[model samples]
Target: MIGLTGSPYGSSFPYAREGSFYLSGYKGAAIWFAPVPLFDHSGVVSTFRQLELTKTKFGSIIKLHLLSLALLIVFSFIFYALIWKLAPIPSGAYPFVEKMWPLQATMETIWIKSTLPGGADVVGRLIRWEYISAGMVFTTLLYGGLMVLKAPPLLFYGLIAGLGTGAWIHYTLPTFIGAMLGKFYFSKKYGEKRWRAYAPVILAGYGCGLGLIGMAAVSLVLIAKSTSQILF
Candidate 1:
């Protein structure tokens, strides 16, 4: 392979760089992306109108939402006043994270997935994600309905609703089975309190392991490359 300044080799790739790979997929989601303010009642009203939801119905939802927000603010002040809130980025780490600002602001993925038609599936899954709020409500109501039938065990209602939701069976099944097994078997063999304390550490270790493995594989490739050498 040849190396040249500014991809004078007539090719440049940025989205595939470290930490950018997965966030790169977000470009496909922005096909018609529109940035909106946090509280965009006009947009909601327009969507409801298009959906033919009665003004009264949407008005009720708006009222309920505002009421919930008010109650949240009130209860948060009352209950969590003692808790401290910090900026999302820590001062010490801000310098490192700030380096990605330009890339984060960009949208172009530059045909990274052009060869794979399945990239369209990624876009569809992302578009479907807009329904998460609705899906959650639907899932809750469905599970509650199962409860009204005097379902034998309440825990299994999750399996029913989760499967009913689009393509989440792969997710919900593993979680349900793992949680059941963990609570019934693993918690007994391994002390629950100790496991709870160590769970985050274990997950962090697993993530670091994956990152190291990827980097190691890339390092080996670079070492094996018999390319033109760079001089200091």
Candidate 2:
């Protein structure tokens, strides 16, 4: 008889058991099983050994690790951009926004909880919203910058990518958009129903889009300063 053992990473079955098992997680699920025994007892063991070796190969493992790392970096950058966009930029006189961009982004994430349904209770939704918001911001910023820099092709690409991502997230994860739209509907139908309630959310959601505007303003200022210096 064959025995099966569950390791911290995966489940392993002895060569004698010619069958399969299943694995499940947040991302998805898969079935893992041993191939059918080909020969006598010794051959069966050898096949199992080969299968295990293939699974644990250094190159394959390394490739998977690198792919995971790349994905993590991409997601993190997107999240960072999103939070940065959501947070309020310090006033020109305050001098803090420029210094504490990351902190401001984090604070904006926290602020989102208050605005969301059930406030702090909906932690999952808050986290998802944060990611989605971040993605939106990053895309907008990239496209907007291209536009300001007079790189029409790059701007067009960015616009396509950003809007596509936003649309996908909106349609695929309607719960998030639904919550936001519901909030808007209710606010308009019941609460203050003024532009103020919607304006803050729009400003927060602008992410990279708003950043591009700031970038353009800075670029103009720099150009003006350079022209003045040249004239003098």
Over 62-128, each residue of candidate 2 has an lDDT whose tens digit, in order, gives 6977999999999889756754454454545325666687786665454444334455623344346
TM-score of each: 0.32, 0.17
Clashes of each: 0, 2
TM-score of 2: 0.17
What's the residue-level lDDT of 164 in candidate 1? 49
Clash pairs, candidate 1, are none
In model 1, the worst 10-residue window by lDDT is: 1-10
Worst 10 residues of 2 by lDDT: 21-30
Candidate 2: list runs displaced more than 4 Å. Answer: 1-56, 88-232
lDDT of 1 by residue, 1-232 (tens): 0122111222223223322434444433333233533332334545566547543665777798899999999977853332223224424324555566546544333233422335533433444555867867876786577779877543343344445442366766786787787788867888898777776687799899999999898556544442456799
lDDT by candidate, in order shown = 0.52, 0.51
lDDT of 2: 0.51
